[model samples]
Target: MAEDMSNEHSQDDSGLHAWMLAWYDHAVSVGFIRPPFLLNDVTAERLEGYFRVGLTPVEGAEAFFGVAH
Candidate 1:
């Protein structure tokens, strides 16, 4: 299950920064996948999976996934 990071930035805790950073990093990484259709029924779960996998190093993939593009 996905962790709720809605208030992650509100906390003054040091760990929150890492959490939020990871989230934004993941979001940017997956945003460049180029889905089949814009109006398609895309869900967060599917996107989350892409983001998770995108975080890893894969053959033929960019050095920084899609985040740097």
Candidate 2:
């Protein structure tokens, strides 16, 4: 029924960000998807995003996922 919206293409522009923020708010209000939540905290909803998007093993496992700090 609600096939009007298209989240396929990413609008990385600043203007798009603002527009999407408003759109997300409205969509949540109308029950399209649940509200956004943090990944660290085990809350209502958390987007895994990409399952296999982490470090490669053996070759340079230590360098992978390394922080600047």
Candidate 3:
């Protein structure tokens, strides 16, 4: 059976957004965001790619986000 996802994108800029932020924070704590996230500025799309492809190396992560080496 398919999971119910009707409200997945419904609560934008609300509690759902906060929950997403919490998930990001968890990722940071688990070293998923890497250090100096400010300098790198990883976007959501790039992060999705990281999850899809697995193991986003520092160089690849930098290049993926268009950060100058």
Best by lDDT: 3
For all candidates, the clash counts are: 0, 0, 0
Given candidate 2, what's the lDDT at residue 28? 56
TM-scores, each model vs. reference: 0.29, 0.33, 0.32
lDDT by residue (2-68, candidate 2, tens digit) is 3333333343244344543554455456555575622243311111111123212221222322354
lDDT per residue for candidate 1 within 1-69, as digits (tens), equals 134474553443444334334554544466635424242334434433444454332321333333563
- Report the lDDT tens digits of candidate 3 across residue range 3-68: 335454354335434544554566566566764555333565554455445443443344444446
Q: Identify the superior model by TM-score, candidate 2 or candidate 3.
A: 2
Ranking, lDDT, top scorer first:
3, 1, 2
Q: Candidate 2 versus the native: TM-score?
A: 0.33
lDDT of 2: 0.34
Candidate with more favorable, higher TM-score: 1 or 3: 3
RMSD of 2: 15.3
* Candidate 3 clashing pairs, residues 3+ apart or interchain: none
